[model samples]
Target: MTLRIRRRRFGQIAIATAATTALSGFAQRAFAQRGGPILYGVTLDSTGENLIIQALNLATGNILPINIQRRIEPGERISAFTAISGRFAIATGPRMALPGRRLGRRSRIISSTTEEIPEPQGLDNDAAFESLLNTNDNNLLSIISLNQGTPPFRFANVDRRSGRVNFLSDVDLLPNRRYSNLCQSPRGTTYGTSLGPDTGPVLVQFDFANRSIITGKARILPIAPLSYNKNLLVNDVADLALSPSNQLFALADPTYEGTNSLFIVNTQTGEMTFLRKFAVQKITFTR
Candidate 1:
């Protein structure tokens, strides 16, 4: 049993599901104070080898399509992506075998400069799959590698202003486990899920300013497994998003199960509250 979902480097798609609880009033007030409506962007799988990227207004549920007229080829498919600074988005495409090479693959990152126009700006990069991506309030891009081998993970920061990419160090203080989901809270703390031996579905936080995980400060938080409904079990997290008020939202899926679910967890308590059972593959929040 294999549950296959979109695997785009720095890009993903979200399929809507049924959930009744509306956005919280406190969250709404937070957005209002931020001076704009909260908008969400999603990439929907469409017919043929293409994806439809669109933006949704969280306040009114109004959706605006960004790439309805664009044609995406197989190698050009988006693997993972995130919106940055409320004005632009950065996305990565599928890995491709370098032509005429013995055995090598390369991935690329592009930016959606404007929602109205689908033209993307390509950023320079070598051959490595970008597994995770997130942006801070200052629009600084954070990217990490998903490749599994010697020095399995590497972190880099992309300066949006100068288009300069800088490799980072000193994050070895974090658990040496694979991270499936990563997001930044409004206050600038980085949170991600670590799935590894002895770790279980653990939520890990890092203080970028301090360049270390808040190890001694917070207790280990683990994501609880959902009871399978008709073979639906959420054992793996596909993606994560953080609200302006620092609420954590996760799109959890099983390796090979019937259905997926959305969960909200409080980092302080390490308790996860099941929010809704939906088929949404990925989700993110912005204001």
Candidate 2:
């Protein structure tokens, strides 16, 4: 099926021109050699009721939409999703009643009865839970208990089989730390999107398995032209992913007033390469 992503804006075209002149070398080095077949599962909410799940072959840039499933409420978008080994997938939203599901082999929604998971105790009234990433096992889900009144954030795990959420530990970040999205690596290294000071959104890795913070340094992303000269500061990232080649990929959420752009960042030096500008709902890569 054809890709059903949001249309590219003219402002993005201008940014593309500038990116060619400014970031040509970086792009060349990043995409010079293609890796093995990289599969990407993407979720789009353009038509709300029919949440679309598609697979993109990153090596060939081919898109094959698996199916459309009616899962969430009319206005709620899928906040997080994880693709399991057996073609099973689980999704969650901020206002979803049944916040999880198991997808069939062809990405069809399998009929299952699941109830909303209860909030973990000990969280103050001001703190709210947000769905994050799934562990390498896929049975355990990682969540962020964001305390609006405090600095340290609480982490937890949710059992998909029983729909029980258990508190894990607290992550103490810098005072200006703000995460927009979460992604996990095969080695259990969890990456998050952090809005950097004066710069664009960046990636921060937390070794959740080892119960330690790996890195919170700002790996700034590129900004779309529409927001370059305006009062808009930096683009916000909605998703952070680790590519098959150990490279990092980030998706910009247009909800922050900036146009959408997909970025490829080097994991070692923290350099970013502008890939493309499109409104992508969700992105996860597989080798």
- Considering every candidate listed, which one attains the maximal lDDT? 1
Please list the Cα RMSD from the true structure of every candidate, rounded to 1 decimal place.
10.2, 12.7
lDDT tens digits, residue span 132-206, model 1: 455554444444544322124455555555545555553442446554456777666667666554445566665
Error of 1 at 195 (Å): 2.2
How do all models score by TM-score?
0.60, 0.59
Give candidate 1 regions above 4 Å deviation: 1-41, 54-72, 93-105, 114-134, 137-139, 146-151, 161-163, 173-176, 197-199, 211-235, 255-260, 269-272, 276-280
Error of 2 at 209 (Å): 5.8
Candidate 2 weakest ten by summed lDDT: 104-113
lDDT of 2 at 69: 37
The Cα local distance difference test for each model comes to 0.46, 0.45
TM-score of 2: 0.59
